[model samples]
Target: MESVVLDEIDLSLIHALTIDGRAPFSRIAAVLGVSDQTVARRYRRLRRADVIRVVGRLDARRLGHVVWALRLRVAPGSANAVARALAKRPDTSYVQLASGGTEVLCGTEASSEHDHAQLLEQLTETRPVLAISAQCVLHVFRGGPAAWPALTTALDPGQAARLDPYPGVAPSEVVLDDGDRALLDALSVDGRAAHATIAHATGWHESTVRRRIDALRSAGALFVDVDIDERLLGVHANTLLLMSVAPAALSSVGEALAEHEQVAFAGATTGATNLVASLMCADVYALYDYLTDRLAAIPAISSIETVPIVRTIKRGSIFGG
Candidate 1:
């Protein structure tokens, strides 16, 4: 279960896995000063309990994918039909039924502005759709999976210790073939590599390369040809707001935060800072002070742990080391 509760050690284990799904249990145990068996047992329990899942987080935009969030209002009795139809497209990455209810979100990848329009058209053409609105996938928050309290202060030392943990992966995982591996390696170096150049380097026909790329996209293993320049795009500043909210204030606080355009991602986890958010801002000062003022304004707020990003480790194309 979803109902399974996580202690500090469990949270730490989660942090480790989130960073690198393939991290070995032994390595995790070493990092946590626990036995490998302890790490394995805890992780197995988490897996069986459906607490955490290990999945690849590839850069979709790097593969030339422009992510968008489509809100679909389907005709009565056609919700399932509409969802099924939308799910079939390779461009679609995430689908959700928003809290207000029947509006289904189809988060997907698009080749370009034209492709996004075509995707919206396709959604409308589907029999069940009554109306559809698509919001571009502006940003993805690489943060804790769920609501986590103030791991920096509120949670027990053992719990907070796992706030920034590590883990490893096993062999026989989703191993990449030569062609795909080479492509990824190249893109890792230069995400904007030209198609003809890539084909020349790989000695594959241009069409063959294209097909393989298509296959990767359909499989949800790769994202090609995405154009996202956050700095130039005016979403230059980023902040990780670590919050400590009283249980009574969580509803209002969470909803209010979620409604803000600045909030890129939100998660509820098992720590003192019950809610964490990734926010984009206009500038360094704004990012810094926005969270400061918001947290101070909340009466139920106990403390705030805001981590302004120093170096962007990896984004659509930018990478640190």
Candidate 2:
């Protein structure tokens, strides 16, 4: 895809949504000092171009789901087919082809141990798969709705405060009932779906639909995210870093990496290499500088392996072309 140049207002609009994906256009316009129609028009253009998408996702941990970061080495000719198959699963997200298209890396959420084991068994039985490794996430330092700062240009604190729709409290654990699941399913498709549409789908009153969604957002059990092709936003490279960090510095290193603007996702995982991070860079040379300068500055890292993302098959709940 050709890159699109973004002006201050364009970037501000994206930043505003990153702060709150479901914020009213009028509210965003007020924050960015533009007409509501302009904000709405630009958003429509971006969405239509596949430059940006808004989606609501459930916190897997709160839902009692085991999240796995899986890597698969497949036969040369089967990478695309295998990746598309994995993308179709309801539990998977961030599926991508990496290592010059010989491997696949993705995140999958399983409802239970049995479900996780079953998925692995199915993959292992596939004829094209040569080997696979699964790493269970122990701690998430960044990712999802909360990690939307990669495209951030600038926004005043006051504008941010006004834009935050769910500001009553920090997220808390909440159990989901059947109605909640129905609501979430709708949101997974479109976070900005109207309450009326959601009500119809869930067989509940519009007011009931609104109330349940509010509760979920307030509890931090669910949050909305905007998915934009980083290339369109001037980010030309993305890499996954597998790093071995000293046991005692795990938390500090993870937290520190989480603070970097290039880091789209960072986490501690159960594996030989304990730290995993996803970074977006301007290009390969920028990535090289980041690894040699920024990453090398970290005292705790003992070793590192970098895998450049060749293509993203899916992100959030939406599949890519």
Error of 2 at 296 (Å): 0.6
Q: Candidate 1: list runs displaced more than 4 Å.
A: 84-90, 113-115, 138-178, 181-321
- Can you write out model 1's per-residue Cα lDDT over 241-311, one digit (the tens) per residue? 66677878776777677656666555443444566666678897877677667645667767776655533
Cα distance off (Å), candidate 2, residue 118: 1.6
The deviation in Å at residue 59 for candidate 2 is 1.7
Q: TM-scores across all candidates? A: 0.48, 0.95
Q: In TM-score terms, which candidate is top?
A: 2
Judging by lDDT against the true structure, name the best candidate: 2
